[model samples]
Target: MYSRIGLTGDVMLGRLVDQYHQQRPVVAVWGDLLDQLRALDGLFINLECCLSNRGEPWQRTQRAFHFRADPDWAVPALERAGVDCCALANNHILDFEEEALRDTLDHLDARNIAYAGAGRTRAEAFEPALVTVNELDVAFVSFTDNTPEYAATETSPGTAYVEIDIGDEETRAAVQETLNRAREHDPDLVIASLHWGPNMVEEPPDTFQKFGRWLIDEGVDIIHGHSAHIFQGIEVYRGRPILYDTGDFVDDYAVDERLRNDRSFLFEVVVSPTGDLSELRLQPTEIHDRSVHEADDEAAKWSRGRMRDLSTPFGTSFERDGEQLVVDFNS
Candidate 1:
């Protein structure tokens, strides 16, 4: 827990099949992100893919969404980028299968970068990762309400999910239970990261609106979500904030048609004492080199305008700072 918790969203360590790691590899691509984000206290993002060294071929389902990263480059990249914790509650965390999941856990452990939202046991999967920053204790829990045919197992690791969907009794109860546990931990702050929403849809389902408000009422300090691969609105209910979708933070690439023209971003949240959100911001990033890049002047402001417009429904405001989308919800 920091005096001001800086939260970001969705870092998918992926190597596009077409742009497969070759000369200017994926590992080289992360250098800039690492340099840019190496100083924030309590930095976090959703772990959007599995990291493995085993040379497994790409696997995909009928709908076709699978992503894996070479742990060798992935782990160090986060470390270099000053990322302290990761939310293992996204659709692709198990892309390569069970063994890959295990390897990912081991890799995370070796790096000493804490993670939550999924684990090798039911209790572990249900628990939050307690991260202490500058002596402040912060707890993080992650989940995915989307992603088909995948559920965390007592003997396996995967994203923590809402069970069925938002508003379902089982899902709300699980969320409530997790919230209760997070409260018991007495964290200075709590970050509830989620992976949800339709892939290319910009608007969140009505169920999610209710869910966000409910979580805020139940004492969640922050509610951050992704999976849409694009930016969505931000809401502030009872003074707590919810960022619905923060399009791809770092993924080598995606073939989604919408992503091509999508105006997306990465948020940096600063929550203060007394449970108030002081800073809700983002830096507009473009997909390139198997990573994200900051756009130049004109392009930067244009991108910010697009994101600002998207967040309007929820009352969150944004502006462009060079290539950064600086947001202020309380202002």
Candidate 2:
């Protein structure tokens, strides 16, 4: 009855990454990590780009970049990795506007890939994607605090947007409503996939930490957080884990020499037979030539050290299990 769920930060297949796909096979994007991803019972990632060929860049507001990939290759790339679900409530989903967003939805639907956070309407945007793995029913809901202009209206198409201020009663009420909707499915576990906060930061603000704890109090089993380009620390509250920031998984963005945005982890959560989270294992990974792969020895060492320093503040400890870092919750 145990289930292994794999989670990653952002998976953006657009711009330069898309160009590389033309020269190489779609599966090349995963490099040697393809087999590792497929080993999990379920995998969820924040799909950080729109898969479409239509629509112009969003001109409704001042935007610096727009990411859109051809569905022909992008959808196959996702399928190749055995992506069970995608969190589409990111800042880049509507980079090419509503037309591209609709196309993204259609492409995922054709592949039977469950996605949440963005949709044709506000109500649809807030809906959850329920999945079953090893008889464990998991509910996933996505939300982003970025790009307020991309927020969906009653009749428009956009993402599930919410401000992350815990002090705001309105924000709390909205989250409660979304939780209520997700509870309707009677899921064994509820995962809140959030694309919040600014990018390139090292740690979450105090408000975000409070908010993450509050979400757990409100019945969320896990908080999958990202947006900051660098991975942050892990905090376990009330027997649930909150991944503050997972950093970039697969992207072509320029590397920040010091921050090393390319360094990340493939997080695997082991859910016990009793439906409680048992262990968290992190397999170090690094992006190279627009593809993701297992981190080399040096990169893996750096990741292990950095994670130890970052997580120690929360009183979290880990044991090196070969190439992977293991955190046992039952300890």
Candidate 3:
């Protein structure tokens, strides 16, 4: 048996979606992307903003951005796209503070959508979201290396955090302990959704690469990393897939033409019932006018070439498979 899982990078629906595209239906904004996502056995994404109408912005003079989407619009849109679960461990999830984080949880709960990496207490924040597809139990655990100030505590509400300082033994031990606990659940597959790395950097840092390999050694079967606004690279360590940064799937931010931040991909991982990866494919994508569309010939070529350059160091290659790019592991 095989299970096809669709994954995407940061999805910011607050400022721009509410401002310009709120009038448009969610399906329209997602366009053909919705059909492709719905066809998968399961779909997951980083919910990069709070879904609420309450709470004030973080009281920081230097804060540059705060994002929140009206639950009325965001929830339905997510449902229409057949999103199975959302990872809430990103920086913007707490932009509206504790009240809005609670509201976001409430709305996701009311809509019957599963979410992980954020909760009212530290324990909940560390919990993993588990979903079964094709009789395979898959677990998702998320953590952010940015903004330790927004992390959850025993009595506070916030996102789960993993300290990025590789030399910090205590932080590394705590993260490993969490993964160990998740491993105790005996899931067929485990995926770590990490919100890390600097924005627009062409390559992933050495520390991140080391931490990812450590997670795989400890138990994680796949590493779904994001936070970088552009596509980074792919690494196949042992047999698991590690997506360094998937880039922005949908957003309203003005594009930086020089960085080509507009280029992105919709990653689809096909896993066998035994928990081994059978295939990995990427659907070249682009964000335009606050919506997602299939990338054109030139854009597709560029996206594929960038991924090839990044993945070559990890000994991973790509081959065109119709409209999508397939990973060539050369088994």
Q: What is the C-alpha local distance difference test score of candidate 2? A: 0.92
Worst 10 residues of 3 by lDDT: 322-331
Q: What is the C-alpha RMSD of each candidate to the true structure, in Å?
A: 3.0, 0.8, 1.4
Task: Kindly report which residue pairs in candidate 2 clash with one another.
Answer: none
- lDDT tens per residue, model 2, 171-256: 88778898998898888899999999998998888989999999999999989999998899999898788999999999999999
State the lDDT of candidate 1 residue by residue for 58-86, as single tens digits: 35454376677777666776776667788
| Candidate that would win on TM-score | 2
TM-scores for every predicted model: 0.87, 0.98, 0.96
RMSD score of candidate 2 (Å) = 0.8
Q: What lDDT tens digits, residue by residue, belong to model 3 across residues 1-331?
A: 7899889998888897766667887676686688898888888999999999999999853568999998877889999898888999989988988999999999988977888889999788888888877788888888898788889999999988878766789768767777777777799988899999778888888988988888888889889999989988899998888899999998888788866888899999998878778889999999887888889889988888888888999888777897688975436
lDDT of each: 0.69, 0.92, 0.86
Higher-TM-score candidate of 2 and 3: 2
